[model samples]
Target: MRSKVLITGSSGKLGKRVLEFNEGLSFLSPSSKDLDITSETSVNKFLNQNSFNTIIHCAALARMMECEENPNKAFLINTQGTLNLVNKVRDIEKSCKTNIRFIYISTDGVYPCINGNYDEDSPTIPYNIYGWSKLGGETTVRSLENFCIIRTRFFDPLNIPFSESADDIITSSIEIDRLAKIINFLVKDEFNGVLNVGNEATTEFLRYISHKPNLKKCKRSDITKNLNFEIAKNASMNISLMKKILSS
Candidate 1:
């Protein structure tokens, strides 16, 4: 039988790319107006009315500085919002007597930036409120029976918003379109648990230089020194686990 898929945050950067790449697949991409993950009544109503075997949850308040400014708002939307979805999914599965595959788009920010090359088994120590809130969501997803928590870093190659790229900061960041393709593959596979998805480790400047030739180079300290919250210098992840799964 064809899988029934529901993608939340479809209007987001990565979510938009996911929809563009998977044009052949039939997916229910609901706007925020149609479904709000933070609202239990809204999520329950949407789930009850629709029959989706898989849910790709990409909804979150993802701005780092914004999250730091208002931690309460971050938790309410990123952490509690995820719990709302999980609860409704649990209820739906119990009532329908069927399994639901949950695909959660997490971040590499969950790891301490001091140490790079993190794997799925690495200890999670978030440096900022954004990371902490996402980690909270991950914890709830981990408790679910059938779920895939993807810790990845991706940016749009064509539309990088930054005028200057950080030369000091490093990460295993992949192009948004590539990341979307990998996610598409994973959603159809029988994989569960956490996976770090990204390309080989590289500096932010090098990653964006090709796309933004005139992009100025700046140090991480230069940017973070003005900010109140701490920033991770090295948040690169080991993508061997993701490679193995995709290869197999």
Candidate 2:
């Protein structure tokens, strides 16, 4: 029998893409209203009614500025909300005597972006509230026997959003469609622990400006001067492990 999968945050871009690339797996995709992860009672009520062998948790307070402005709300949803799901999953798995795999969507922000080339064993000192909140969620997911924490950044290539691209700023941000494909493959792998996925170290302008011809090339200052929070500089992650897994 195919694994019964529960996909949270199906409304989000990543979640939606994952659903699109189902890869012949059985999926139970629910919107935020149907399964409010922030509410422990709501999570329990929903999961109790269904049985799942895998959970691809993509729900999160993902905005950087919003997380910084409202740290409490960020933690409530990203941290506490993840804990609620983890706890309940444990209960259900124990009762049913079946293994449940959890795939957590984490951010590359968990690493200090001071210098790039971060490996899986590198220090995890978050530079912002968004990273901290996701790290808290990671802590809970670690308690599970089978879990994969994907730490990377992804952007919709079609929608660059910004008119200016910083040539100096670098990141491990991959195209949304590519990242979704990797996640679809990861769902079947039995790997436990964090897996860094994305392109090699490259400037933001070169990676992002290709899709937008009108986008002007600029220095990092031109972008950060207007923003309140600091955009991660050189947030590149080493994806050697990810490639190995995909190849295997």
Position 23, candidate 1: lDDT:
44
Q: List the lowest-lDDT window of 10 residues for candidate 1.
A: 17-26
Model 2 residue 167 distance off true place after TM-score fit, in angstroms = 0.8
- List the candidate 1 regions with Cα displacement exceeding 4 Å: none
Query: Tens digits of per-residue lDDT for model 2 on 94-175?
Result: 9899889999999999999879889888999998899999999999999999999999999998988888888888898999
The digit string of per-residue lDDT tens for model 1 on 1-248 reads 57678999999988888888774467999998789888888988888888878888998999999999999999988999999999988888888898999999999999997879999999999989999999999988887899999999898888889898798899999989898998888788899999999999989999999998999999998888899998879989999998899999
**TM-score per candidate:** 0.97, 0.97
